[model samples]
Target: MRRLTIWSIPIDREICAGDNLGDLLGATGELADGDVVCVSQKAVSKAEGRVIQSDPEHLDEAFEAALAAETRRVLRVRGTTRIVETHHGFVCANAGIDRSNAPAHALVLLPEDPDRSARRIRDRLRFAWNLHVGVIVTDTFGRAWREGVTDVAIGVAGVRAILDLRGTADWTGATLRVTEVCIADEIAAAANLVATKAAGTPFSVVRGIDPAWLAESSARAIVRDSARDLFR
Candidate 1:
């Protein structure tokens, strides 16, 4: 009896540095209660002026500096591929410095503070429409030993990123020992299906979720601590 709807809302303008993304989003269709907005990480980064130019023929000094600046620690390196831990505790390739869809010889870094960005967007939407909703900033990431990539929530605001069903009875009357669902991440993945890179879409709205799960929380709550991390 549960239902949800995901739709991609395209912004046709070329986003630039110092652009007011809050205003840009507000200009879109009016938001409603329980609507969760998923934004592309590249869009946020572009607006934040987090782009750098690489050399034309070879990797330049800027590339190395960027890699070092964004990476907190190197986890693994095979040939030219590197898996690093970002300062935000995200484990990804090259600290999530993306070059796709950017201008020639340029790369886009992750938002400076994704959680803060989400909060700012959430607050702006509330102020504009007096609507209580959630915002999630998403990025594509490959799974360990898995082919292809899936979108995940790197930032969240005004919503609980996880649903802790531990100790809750299941359909068979069995208690769930450890069944925490990353709600925001699931929403991001669904939205990403519509906000495809080749489709020229970078944002989506997800509807029909439990608003009770909408709270003032950041995606940091979903991050696994280093102490509990089994993979390097």
Candidate 2:
């Protein structure tokens, strides 16, 4: 029988600047091999010093210039500014600059290199605990066709991002069509079931996924490049 265990563990406090992730996780318990640890991107941003301070009510010329330089397109505009998609294919209000739940006079943005962040964390955990576990940094993102939003993987290490089923034979011996599975996104969603936004649970562990599904992979496997994106 296959057994899986999902654990939602609370950190001592919200991840902030100067907090050592290895120390924090070590205080909780030993991480086992084949475990998938999902971390919220907000925490990763905080750790990476990707935070700024600005008044939400005011859109200064400098702020507008920064947004223009970073965004691909201006989705909508209100009084001060609007939501925009970054060159990296992430769409969010003010290019992922967020002021929520942050210290006063600060707006948090996504890490500069999320993949590097994942790799760093994965390496630290492995060295500290001697375990072979995968790491994923996740964030809540709004979908084009979907109403609400769901957590998705932005950074990953030691996991296969996609399960390609193209040209694979189905149960009836017919070739399957469109059978690729966004495994990272699915794992991110499953982790969200335990890591709730309002509950202050920013970390979760997903166990029991087939070990074969996890190979050293990058988020690029899951993110659709602009030229290949049909919806855009």
Candidate 3:
């Protein structure tokens, strides 16, 4: 039987620009070999100074400008919400910008290169702790037909983003097709069970992942190319 365990690590202090996230997380002393670390996107953004000031007096115009700056193309607009493609090729609401959980009069933008951000954190941890682990940067995203939101992996390192099971045989001895699993997103969602948005728990550790899944990977692999995307 495969078993898994997950728990949150509370960041004792607010993460600010230029903060060393690797050092801060390492200080938590909760990580172990083979543990997958799920970090909130807000924490990474704050640390990386990926924030922009929004004028409160003209917030709507400021927001629109920010949205335009971050957006690659506008796909849908309903009321004040926008579903658009970002420069990073992520299709999400408002280009993955967040007004909540940000410094006053500021908006947090997604990391410039999430895959690279994940690698930096992974490498830093490897150097600091001498432990091999996977790192995932997570953000909340709404599904096309689903209600509400769930955390998904926007960045991944030292972990397989997708588990392709197309040729695998099931218990009934049937060949499986089109059964690729988004491992990073699923892990991020599971971590959200403990790393609640308002809990100040920006980090979570998922243990007991299949060791075979630990390898060089990035979340970009999870994005479906437009040529194959039917919804867009």
Candidate 4:
């Protein structure tokens, strides 16, 4: 049986530049095989010094033009509120420039290489604690049809991102269709149950997953290229 658990951790200060992820996690406890550690992207970005100070409310004519050109269409602009789907295929408010949870006059940008960051964290945890565990960097994302937002995997390591059951037979001997489970995304969502925004829990440990699904691989495997994205 597959089960999930989320643990609330105490992260007192904002994760800033030059923070060691391994040390932070070790201070809490030791990890074990098949364990999944979910980390919020906000902390990862902060540790990487990706914060920027900018007034998203005021965009010059040139900035507006650039945004329009990059998106290939006019994005939603209501007064100062702007939501755009960039050419890189990310749909976010203010082009992913986040102002929440940041110090005054600063906005946090997504990490440049989230997958690499996940790998780094995983490796460090393994080296420091001698544990085999998976790491997932999560971010809150709005779905296409959903009204509210949910946490999704921005980075993952040491776990199978997708559980492919294409040729697997069902109970009635019928082949499964569209049964590629997004295991990483599921873990991220489960972690959010404990790592809530109001609770200030930026980290959570997910336990009780099938051991066979654990593997050392890049999160890039989960990203669907435009040419292969059937929905797009």
- Measured against the true structure, the TM-scores of the candidates, in listed sequence, are 0.94, 0.88, 0.97, 0.84
CA deviation > 4 Å runs, candidate 3: none
Candidate order by lDDT, decreasing, is: 3, 1, 2, 4
lDDT for model 2: 0.78
96 in model 3: Cα distance from truth in Å? Answer: 0.8
Clashes of each: 0, 0, 0, 0
> Order of candidates by TM-score, top first?
3, 1, 2, 4
Residues 99-206, model 4: lDDT tens digits? 667766576667777788888888888888777888898888776567988888878888888889999999999999889888898989888888757756777888
lDDT of each: 0.85, 0.78, 0.90, 0.75
lDDT of 3 at 190: 97
**What's the CA error at residue 214 for candidate 4, in Å?**
1.3
| Per-residue lDDT of candidate 1, residues 1-232 (tens digit) | 8688889888876678887666677777656778898988988888888988767765456677898999989999988668999999999888898876887899899998999888888888788757677999999987798999899999999888998899999999999998999988898899988875775576788888886888888889877888899996
lDDT of 1: 0.85
The Cα error of candidate 4 at residue 29, in Å, is: 0.7
**Candidate 4: pairs in clash:** none
lDDT of 3: 0.90
Q: TM-score winner among the candidates?
A: 3
Residue 168 in model 2: lDDT:
95
Q: Model 3, range 44-107, lDDT digits (tens) per residue? A: 9989999888678876677788899999889999988999989888899999989887778888
